[model samples]
Target: MASRAPGEPDYQRLAFRYEPMAGRGERRPVIVVGAGPVGLAAAIDLARQGVPVLLIDDDDKLSQGSRAICFAKRTLEIFDRLGCGQRMVEKGVTWNRGKVFVRDEEVYAFDLLPEGGHRRPAFVNLQQYYVEGFLLDCALALPAIDIRWRHRLTGISQDENGVTIEVETPEGTQSLACDWLIAADGARSATRKALGLVSSGRTFRDRFLIADVRMEADFPAERWFWFDPPFHPNRSVLLHQQPDQVWRVDFQLGWEADPIEEQKPEKVMPRLRALLGEAAEFELEWVSVYTFSCLRLDRFRHGRVLFAGDSAHGVSPFGARGANSGIQDAENLAWKLGLVVKGLAPETLLDSYDAERVEAADENILASTRSTDFITPKSEASRDFRDAALDLARDCPFARRLVNSGRLSVPSTYRTSPLTTADRDAFAGPLEPGAPVPDAPIRIGGREGWFLDEVGGAFTLIVFAGQGALPDTDALRPDPLPLDRIVVTPPGQDGDPPLHARAVEDREGLLARRFDAAPGTVYLLRPDQHVCARWRSFDAAAVAAALQRAAGGEIGRC
Candidate 1:
């Protein structure tokens, strides 16, 4: 264990405990490698679904420094489902507005969450160590998870049925087997290396210095980005406020900058003074120089071994997509893997994980590549284009869309996913099939609550209704996979709660508006809270068919 440091998280080393099963040649259902935010999230989500998991990590303590600080809304919502969202939110700085500046002059700004009625904020800035600690605590509370620290996976081989792995622990090297293996060991993944897999993509030729400074300043909790600032002419700079009076400052150090020299306090302090003025008081808590690449494997799944998080894909940190997308990967995979492990769905269902997440990775890669290009243009023409966009953004609203100070992270919509059932009726909003279910305020049994909290972690049929009679959902329930139903009626409507399904009131009319629901709108949500199918009205047969499709049963539908 490490001693606590002032203005820093105490990095406590976890004692290595040898697993006796390694001596017995016993096999576990799921084994997750690397206990970072992604691996821990995967383990906790799997455990919540009654899937036993053996989580192993090479490091004994939490990662040093605030590696990933800007957590997006969708990631926080997933954390909320994992039982630690509130803790992260309370301990982190929350913000939605982001301002763009060009040469020390203020340009247009944007609000990530322009509208209200969402349960969580658009983004929360928290240190990665705090996130890992919270997720670690959640995993520790679950009996189904056995987390082993200081367990390094040195070798791996997978066949049609399972995967065999060799792990080097503090005691000795041992062989272990698992029915399924999730490789989340990060960008320099040992698991990916053992498999002889390749992650091909372009690596940007630029570096940035991240300085986490502890200061008692009254900066607003918003994202501030400057392009070609006066202090650092022809370079970019970003500012973000974090909890505990720590402000994250990123200075664009081009390819010519020496990373070793740039990280020293003498070099870093001058840059800070240039931005914060000479009289500003602050202490550097952590500092590092990093270059990023947008890359991902050709596929996320190989036989019974699945790759997740950075092991599966990676994006530049500009948009905070690395950890956010990794966490999304964990959420997207856990439910499908859970069903497959439980024999509720065929092993083929896991293929959808590959299809959907690959698309997501591609989307993130595209966005990240664009942001990197705009931020650090390789050619003079590209830099001119970016500058023009930023300059015109002040007067023209259309030009504002061209500026890319990191699109920020948003949940992916698996529109082409094999499991999605195309809408048979016209929809008026963004709640399309394969879209994540939007969260909204609601009232349940006269108590205020969130719409998503009432219906997730299972296959649910949500029917938006009015004061009219509720639809009968008795015939909608399927065997072996009972479909839970919820009736969300408009507020101030006189009605008795339905006996067959849980009922909630759309207190602010946000639910109905967000989902584009009318008196009889119906939506079938998967266990992961993504819409598989929807209709203008409740159709039991349609709901059942969509349910089957979502559960890996084709039912002769696309």
Candidate 2:
């Protein structure tokens, strides 16, 4: 076993023994299995909030492959919170177009840019390996996190005080205790299986041949697909560009494969040539065959064990929603877990994690299922319908619009969520309270324009047009919690809004309408862009009480 340097990010050669904490380091708050995106995300979040986390994974090195490439704007917003969005944007390609071909002929093309006044929806195609490395680097740098590789979770048992995890390491077997455990060990999750969680979803009849290649081709930098795929001799093919000139190529295995014929790259290349014609000169970086399946665990949390990422939900990689959804899983669960570990909210608050995340994971499954269904449809009739739709889309811009947008990933509005407002007319329509606040760019003090997300962190109190005095956030504010920067839009007026809540110069609803505010309405937005609470206008007492309740406390004390 090896150990990482004090500040060196990569810890591949390092391992830490689980010494039973008896004195200073006896009880840990959480133990997370799997060092993938979701696991690392959870660890970082807990560490940020001063919780101790021990992360375990079997893999020693980051998995290399352009597995999941596309990241939605919501995912970017999440990275923004963690201070990584700028680097991601700088390192990835923000795609806005896609092309579809039928029988080697261009059939349809679509623009993905947001229409109307919607915020620009851009997706990045970065190799999953790089992303993990970046996140791992960030996570391990924190003093409260310890990531252990070559550790496979074999058994887990929990009691009243905490949970115990049995791991098989190179040296020997060991047990670690913690307040809770997160199972992010992928679809064939050992942890989920141990808890007897049921996951059910259909496997597609056809298989897909995936080839990650470094290609310098004439094709534009976009998601390129060939319909009526000759490679499959039935379905179609897709190509996604990655950061380093690598492309993820997928072709449906239309015909029953002869094990002998399927093994040869020559066979696959010939078929690819038939489709690409002159453009087939592109080089193949790596290739493998993967089966497409859609599955979701019956539960996202079980006792002290919670599942995120593929362990909670599995989707075909066609739409690349899998990892993005998992990252979101971390964002939601992390905050709640932070509060629970801190004793702000009851452990029962963990139940809502399953409820809300299960809904979002279902959304991801449906979207990826649809994308898979469209690309490698089950029935011949369905395949024909898909082709015809693409052809028609080429002729009609309206038809192309939907295909192009890929339905742009929108945040799930937890309308029925226990964490949401049940008041019927409390919040505005078109957007939900617990959903990602639509990007409304309002100029700050008449100088520059920034979107709603740029309004800074912490709870945002959105005061509608011409409202009243600032709520007595101090009254309800929890002890050690800061609410001093509360921004009030005012009782009525058209002026610039302050950058931070506490910096207003006595006038402006600048950021309120940026979030689509209405007069006589007050909006409270959470750090993850969800609505926490709201009112008609700012009332010192009532608002303070609600804020107190929202803070899970009285006048002061978290």
Screening candidate 1 with a backbone cut-off below 3 angstroms (N, C-alpha, C), the clashing residue pairs are none
Clashes of 2: 10
lDDT of 1 by residue, 1-558 (tens): 111336544433334455544333878999999999999999999999999999999867777788899998889889988999998998889999999988877776889999889989999999888899888889989999998887899999878878999988877888889999999899999999999999999889999999999888877999999988989888899999987788999999999999999999999999999999899988999999999888899999999888999998888888889999999999999999999899888888888999999999999999999999899887889988988898898788898889888989999998988899998999986678899999999988888989878876889888888646667877666888856788888887534656768888899999998998889888899888899999988888988878888988872333
Residues 128-227, candidate 2: write the lDDT tens digits.
Answer: 7667776776886898987777788888898877888887877777777889998988878999777767789988777677777665555567878776
Cα displacement (Å) at residue 313, model 2: 0.9
Best by TM-score: 1
Clashes of each: 0, 10
**Segments in model 2 whose C-alpha atoms lie over 4 Å from true places:** 1-25, 104-108, 115-121, 229-233, 258-263, 275-281, 380-384, 387-408, 423-429, 440-458, 464-475, 478-485, 488-501, 504-511, 518-521, 540-558
lDDT of each: 0.88, 0.67
User: What local lDDT does model 1 show for residue 489?
Assistant: 80
lDDT of 1 at 76: 86
What is candidate 2's CA lDDT for residue 500? Answer: 36
Error of 1 at 291 (Å): 0.7
